[model samples]
Target: MARAHFAYFHPFEIRFSEVDMHGHVFNGRYLDFFDTAVTGFLVARGCDEILSVDGAGNGVDMADAAAPVYFVRRAGVEFLAPVRFRQRVEVAVGIARMGRSSLSFALEVHGEGEDAPRACGEIVWVAVDRATGRSAALPASLRDKLAPALLPQDAAPASGGA
Candidate 1:
């Protein structure tokens, strides 16, 4: 994917705890990096606070809610290169598709000054009813705020084939 396509990036350092005995970052850790990037992106856009659903499925304040939080429904990743310790990786993420109840994310993990990424992939997340754990429509306000960071038309093929 082209670097210019992504509008959000979160830089992270490779901690010693993240590396395997072979000195390369563990495969599972890439998911952590992407998760962090996604959270950062949403927070930066002020969308995180919208997740205040209560156990009864009503929208409420986080301080008074015990909602079932957002959950990843599916994720896919392709490791392009091995990332080792002592390196800073910049994870760039963009919204590929936003649906009534789901969102698809495209992400690229790049090392400093590198043209190619250490890894690239997509994650699918579904908003769920807190009490039932079933899919729920995403709030219009949240989607509107995230519209500016959606991937360009050519970057990912959106499903609403209209």
Candidate 2:
């Protein structure tokens, strides 16, 4: 759990379902947006899609691979701005560290180029043994693919990001 940060970027759109009674995206929806961007970033880096394969094409053939499921063990998020209906946003996701049983990420969210982040968060990932659903090492090949995208800096550890 030493610090080793690596950064990445991806884009998304705000949807009506993501909003709350206040007309702004609900606090929880940000996490979904964060996941969308992170998934996209990892796919671009050639990692097997952990969640789905429909949009990532058959190159990695996620469905045919020995997929390892990851569970969020911890997260730390800071909301800096509000996102309203129909706004498009982009998030930058970075790995701040990698450990034997887990990995850490830094996420920066923005309204697609407004010069300021709408939010920033840290995410922690741990591979789980599919059958037992307990902690395990991230698969070596997948780790190799994801390693190149780790942020070039470091930060204090955050336990998880869901």
Which candidate achieves the best TM-score against the true structure?
1
lDDT of 1 by residue, 1-162 (tens): 677788888998899999999999999999899898987787777775554544444566763243334678888778778999989989998888898888888888889867677788888888777777788787777789889988886653222121
Per-model root-mean-square deviation over C-alphas: 5.8, 4.9
What digit string (tens of lDDT, one per residue) describes model 2 on residues 30-121? 77877777777776776646655645455444543345578888876777779898898877777767888788877877776665667778
Model 1: weakest 10-residue lDDT segment is 153-162
Instruction: Assess every candidate by TM-score.
Output: 0.82, 0.74
The clash count of every prediction, one per candidate, is 0, 11
Where in model 1 is the C-alpha error above 4 Å? 51-60, 63-69, 156-162
